[model samples]
Target: MRQKSVLVVGAGLSGAVIARILAIRGVHVCVVEGRNHVAGNCHTVRDQHTGVMVHAYGPHIFHTDDAEVWRFVNRYANFKQFKNQVKAQVGGGVYALPINLHTINQFFGKTFDPNAARAFIQAQTTPVIAPARNFEEQALQTIGRDLYQAFFKGYTEKQWGRAARDLPASLLKRLPLRFDYNDDYFSHRYQGIPEAGYTDMVARMLDHALIEVQLGVRFDRVDARGFDHVFYSGAVDGYFGHSYGRLAYRTLDFETRSYEGDFQGCAVMNYPSADVAYTRITEHKYFAPWESHERTICYTEFSRDCGIGDIPFYPIRLVHEKQMLAKYRDLAAREAGVSFVGRLGTYRYLDMDVTIKEAMQIARTYAKKAGVAALPAALEAAA
Candidate 1:
């Protein structure tokens, strides 16, 4: 019998994890990435001038509640305990994010206990008897007008390039409103960043003898002829050449600057006010607190509509996009010997852990059997 050879498209977390798993099972894996380097958007490198590890695409903190996923990443590289304590600069005062007890007290200038804070927030709500109609309604119903305006309204608008009312109510459902002092942005049990950097970790994952990674090489559907099967992690729409139409996605533009000392004093500081064109500023040095760096590098993040030839970040699954996604999914279903995986392939925003977990699952399934199946609703909701 001929050796089972698979072509893995894109060398991001999803592709790397999948490639590693398949290689362990004695499968010949070929990973083709359009970018010159591995790790995709999570690519990290040290600044020659400042000696700070910079998150090339944007700030990506590895956070997950899954124990297996945590162990899997730790196998590759050491991760330091890192908490994403985000701050928002709004209305002349800077406050902690996720609207914790500290934020509530600071914003309203009142010191209240958990129960009292909860009651106060409840009282501030608009008292909508029906379910929330939109993102704005959801915010007003959960945190009330005052807190919503200060923290979410302008920032959400700037990030999505749409009015809060125009966005779906489900968008605000994930945002936690805590009555306690806990200000950690994510509620995950395991949250940290790799000590060596994401690129090093991904490089270790792709280090298997059976795996061959081709950087700066673009692979299309036609190129899957030689391999027995193909695992595609690129844009699903692009796979089919956007026959239906280009799916809507929000891309980020980062303006990086070198600072002599601490710039924002935090990993991420959000500018919620509408006056600010950029949404947030991220200081790279804070991501790895274990390391000492005298100088710092910061990035000012700006969110905008993804144009042609732009790197798509967040998939905007509004009504039109959903319809277009369904059409592309149907096309994928008809296609043979190919499986779509990861954020771009599924057209959803996925965290690092979820991406690795799904990749492992898909790879294991494929290794056990010759036929590989696509992940259905792996991390976040698709389409």
Candidate 2:
């Protein structure tokens, strides 16, 4: 019998890491990427017009407390110390996000201490609905209508293209309110951007003698009989012929502009007043603040329902979508010689750290299998 050659569809980080690991162990691997670039949504490139390191898709910040994943990524590329600070413009004033101490003082026209701030916000929130029902109800219960309307309500509506009242309460967790002056977006210990860009990081991972990369190639499984195992990192619903119908997804459209100098004083600014058509404006130069460019590039992000030919960015796991996803998952479970991973495959929003960690776990399972007879166990363990 011929040796089993593994074929991985999608050259994203998840697929790249898996291929890199197997290739290093003397296993033959083939990577098929439909896109010309390797990194999927995390793809970054230098803008020829603005000469800035632009996040081609959108703003992607590497943030996580997982030391193992952080260390693993650093081995291939260097990461700069970048802290995310997000500001929102509401009611003709800009305030720090995540409802920090400074935001409360600015929002209500008063400066209060830590204890006073907590008490003030608590008093502001109404407990009309005993148990919160929808996102609006949860917000009103947590921080009251004033702050909720000013901060979350409009932003959520803009991003999801639905009213807060229609959304589920489970979407809003314990409203993270900081009594201190901390306004950092993420609470992760490790937060930074790859100095050489994410595409470079993926390139470094896939650069191997035993690996054959085929860009602009689609795997149909109709006339393919070479590979021993196949990995699908795309939409699970599409993989199964949309048998359970297409899972709902939210896609993003970026409106770009060239600016002479600093556009927004910061990296990200949210116009959450319901008046602005777009939700947020991201300055690409801010992502790479270390190197200054003569011109700056900014993207006005507009989120909408995923249509045909549109790249699905965020999965909207609503009640109906959840039921459809369950059916798709069952179909995937019964499939052979294939394992699914990543956001689209699993139908979950995953950061870079989680994506890499999942790939690492998949690699371990494959290594333990050792032979063809044990590959099914490896697939089960990976799933």
Candidate 3:
């Protein structure tokens, strides 16, 4: 009998993880990536000028509550403890992000305790609207007009290129207005950046003998019939030739600048004012605090609607996009010997941990059904 062969599209976290798992399970995996390098959006490279590890696409801080996922990553590369303490530049002043007690007290010029701060914010909140409907309404009702306008209004408009009133309230669900001094962006059990780099970690994951990684190769060029199973991690709309219409997405443009010394003095600093064209500036050196650098590299991030050739970063899952996504999902379900996985495949923004977890789960499911005659059906069902 011929050995089972699998075609894994996009040699990113999703594809690499899945390929690694399947290869370990005695399946031959061929990993193809459109980009010249692996690790997908989390690709990191050393900046020759500054000798800083630049997050090529953008800053990707690995933070997750899943112990298994954390352990899985650590198995391949060492992760340094890094806390994402984001600073926001609003009203010509720096403030701790996530709207903590220090920010509230500093903004209001009061030494209120957690309870007092909570009460004060509640009072400041819009009392007229009992239940908030949209992002704007929710912001007003939760943090009141002053805080919302100063921090969220302009930034959100620039980020999404849409009024906060037009966005769903669910979008701001994780954005917390804390009463304590904790300024850590995420409340995850684990948070760190890989010591070597994301690309190195992914390369290690694809080091198995059964896994063959072919970079700068488009998925469309591959012959799917050659493989018993195909795992696609590219854009779902692109796979179907966008017959239903392109799904809405936001892409980022980075303006990187080199500095002699410490530039921003922080990993990330948000510009929450309409006056600034860029949303935030990231100092790459700060991402790896363990390493000392005489020079620094910073990137001013600009968000815009994803164009035809632009790389899609965030999915704008509005009502119209949702409708189109449903159509694509239906089309994908009908595809034989193919399974859509990862952020682009599912049309949802996924964290690193979740992506790895899902890939591992899918690969395990495929391994379990390796001997079964109805493997394709089981794989499609799992997807």
Candidate 4:
């Protein structure tokens, strides 16, 4: 045995991957997941009522350009190739998202050449100061009043629970727009969903006999000294007692409905208009189209600022929050005996592949770190 023990918190994709890698390398590992399930926000289970899979929190479509990340996930679960093509409903018309040539032509009801289309957009964009201020300015600069109002203004306000003008311009740094008729939301080389769902993949990852997983258990309740080392994956703020201050996050509310047949023609439809309370609607059956079922299920996602009782999904990283995060990082740098791993610990919006790659990297790096441990003979005792 190289490393005797490690205490891991939050059994999301990151913690699970780290724990599995550590266990494979002859380290005794114990994973503590605050939730009863393992996959965290990516958790999905088959609905008992309809037998259709439900995204417990929200829809998390996997997309990536990294070949290593793609191959790593494929080892545990088979992925069906699924490209995301999103539709936005604005001004009583459905248009392709990311402002591709198809969207521009359809919106204007004109067939313009690529060069003409590009020039037209440049003319339409608003002129502002050299540097943009907020999200509204960013949108306005990219596409002036007409298009910005139609597409970004309302929906963005609802999602963040703040005015677009108040939000940071960096939020929309990469405004997706095109002069060609490509409507794909993501330009990644690989994109898909797990064939059976995320749970099946996680279950396989934690299948090692040496790895012990206890659900609905908090890491703080467990004795830290018993484990040779600890891998904390929960929110760094929560782990550190929120001594500095609580970080702000945005959570989502999902309302699901079942339909006899196809509810929406596409997998996802964005309601950019403020009149609609929900931001977007997602059809789950379309997520796994290899096998068809009689009925379909859909969920309308609504984003709002996280409250005391709400489950935090996306971190609201604005200017003030970034300043606060710097302090937290300083504290984490000195958080002895505990190695923080995962999105919450790192505090970034990481996808499945990024999370997995990071965890694997941490595992390998820490395995070498075990050599410098004060208690060199602990592994033999643990065995």
TM-score each candidate. Answer: 0.96, 0.94, 0.95, 0.93
Give the local distance difference test score of model 2.
0.85
Looking at candidate 1, what is the lDDT of residue 329?
A: 94
Provide the lDDT at 224 for model 2: 39
lDDT of 3 by residue, 1-383 (tens): 67899999999999999998787666899999999999999999999999999999999999999987888899888999999999999877899998999999999889999999999999988885366788998888889888999999999999999999999888777698899999999999999999999999999999989999998899783568778999999999999999999999999999989989999889999999999999999999999988999999999999999999999999999999999999999999999878899999999999999999999898887777776233354453332
Tens-digit lDDT string for candidate 4 (155-217): 889988888988989777756778898877788898988998988888778878778999998
Say what the RMSD of model 2 is: 3.8
List model 1 lDDT by residue over 287-371, tens digit each. Answer: 9888899899999999999999899999999999999999999988888888899999999999899899899888877766785
Q: Compared to the true structure, candidate 1 yields what TM-score?
A: 0.96
Model 2 C-alpha lDDT per residue in residues 58-150, reported as the tens digit of each score = 999999999878877887789998998999989878899878999989999888999999898889887664788789988887787899989
lDDT of 1 at 345: 95
**Model 4 clashing residue pairs (backbone):** none
Please list all clashing residue pairs in model 2, or write none if there are none.
none
